[model samples]
Target: MKNYLILAAGLAFAAPAATAQSTASATGAAAAPISAGQRKAAEELLAATDSEKNLSATIDRMLSAQLEQNPGMKAVEPEMRAYLTKYMSWPSMKEDMVQLYAREFTEKELRELTKFYQTPTGRKTITKMPELMAAGMEIGQKRMQEHLPELQQAIAEKLKSQPPGAVK
Candidate 1:
């Protein structure tokens, strides 16, 4: 259950980034030409975002909070520790996500995107995205809670309809 919640949280956070990447791709075809200075500015903004650092911090915080919420998780601490060790050791996950973005946009397209993001308007959007995502997740959680009872009841009824001693 905790794992599922963590996965949900991750997806929720990633959605905005995914949207940004898609938008970059979609607008790539006819984007306004960017100057060299603009490209450099965008690169600086990207560096400042420090995606890997942010992701690592978020993961650490989430895992710590999960362990606190579920003391039984202590029994699986070794597994969790091993998983985090492996995950953190792989520098490729962030690269892979970036590569996906790269694949979606040409080099010129990426430069233009970087240029736009470096601007005040773009910077503001980037800064507010995390908070926007958190709000989205809150809304999602409320909707899930609203439907949970009905979902549980449906599952219970379906299970009850099954034959006794049947392999699930």
Candidate 2:
């Protein structure tokens, strides 16, 4: 449950925009203040990334694949769709993200960021990010696989050492 909550929180707040973290920290909450121009720039940058549209497509593909793999999931498909639609809809994520940007960055920085994202390099970065993240996750999975047996052994040892009451 803890892990699920953590994952849910992470997913809930996760902006699809790769630059959002950097963009937020660029100015920070304590820095001067944001201006209208900066807000506009942030909006532009967000628009350029098209994170919501891309994420929506990716999620749809994921759900479709999941359904294809396990037809039994059809029993809960409507509930799952409702949950995602209510909480993870593009509009909800975008609105939360805009507020986050406004809180994090100065107006000037946001505008500059918008300009940066408009360039060819920026566009390329946007297009390649999903692949990059997927590859990174694969690497992490492989590393975990290499150590999983050792981890399981350690857990077994810990469980064996624990008192019967502690075991439960």
Candidate 3:
């Protein structure tokens, strides 16, 4: 009777351990995976940069400057401005940018990124990034000018090889 009682107690304890293992396996299998839409939304959320609004404004200013500097290109300025305005539709752009950024980061990574962005240096970089981009564009334009003749010649030759009435 004593041996039988010990065996029963041991069986009782072992039963719960076996149950716990099965429960854990079931839960691990039943968990739902992330959907594509959910992933996309998270990505867009993360991609939202602090500089988005200021960057749009800076781009508008640069376009205006370009129109002013080259009067001949002024004929197309209105169309260009309209296109830029359409492309930079602020609310949707912001949403998409945020989603894109969010996709690349896990929840913990986003928390870290938000903490950094909240700091003074991060804020300063966010504010100045648009102006820095404009400066880089100005430098790129100078380089493009130097290569324009060669670029034009290459385009002309490529066009010449196309079939007659083909879209140029």
Candidate 4:
């Protein structure tokens, strides 16, 4: 559970810099500084989502499903479990996500979210968010897996095309 989330989180953390570099001509992270009120609203939304707990549960379910499909995974399951528990603990993840949310959204947007999420429709969305995120993650994993062969071929071609001294 933690392995997938951990890797995704790492990528997500790095994605912004890449995006910023790519979109340098675009509006940067400088519309306006996020206010304390908006920060509070963001924190409220985070609490309502149970973001970290939900991720931990989802990871548990995913790992269980994986182990079921591959019995051999049991051999290293204990070590994997220990690593996630130590490195991707709920407290650390929750703190990280809260900061991410605060940095990405404004107070006005967060306040609106607080208002909307309290509604019945919002409640449903909240309930289903984990399922949606998990499904999306699975789709992303499949797509990335699908690209591996082409990516590997591209790398091999690049290596072959380079001069002998370029390899060094």
Instruction: List RMSD in Å for every model shown.
Output: 7.4, 5.1, 25.6, 6.0
lDDT of 1 at 16: 23
Q: Give the TM-score of candidate 2.
A: 0.71
lDDT of 3 by residue, 1-168 (tens): 343244234332222123444454556654334456555544433343444455456556656665575667677666765765565445535543444344345666655666666678867876776568568867989999999999999989988999988954
How does each model score on lDDT? Answer: 0.61, 0.68, 0.55, 0.65
Cα misplacement distance, residue 151 of candidate 3 (Å): 1.4
Give the alpha carbon lDDT tens digit for every residue of 10-36 in model 1.
533453266665565567755455455
Q: Residue-wise lDDT of candidate 2 within 1-168, one digit each (tens)?
A: 343344345454344643665565665645445566766766776787776777676556555655676677777767766767777777766755665676666777676777777799988987887678668867989999999999999999999999888976
Against the correct fold, how does model 1 do in TM-score? 0.58
- For candidate 4, the per-residue lDDT at 70 reads 68
> Candidate 4 at 75: error in angstroms?
5.2
Error of 2 at 90 (Å): 1.3
Q: Rank the candidates by TM-score, best first.
A: 2, 4, 1, 3
- Model 4, TM vs. native: 0.61
Find the candidate with the highest TM-score and give its number. 2
Ten contiguous residues minimizing lDDT sum, candidate 1 = 7-16
Clashes of each: 0, 1, 18, 1
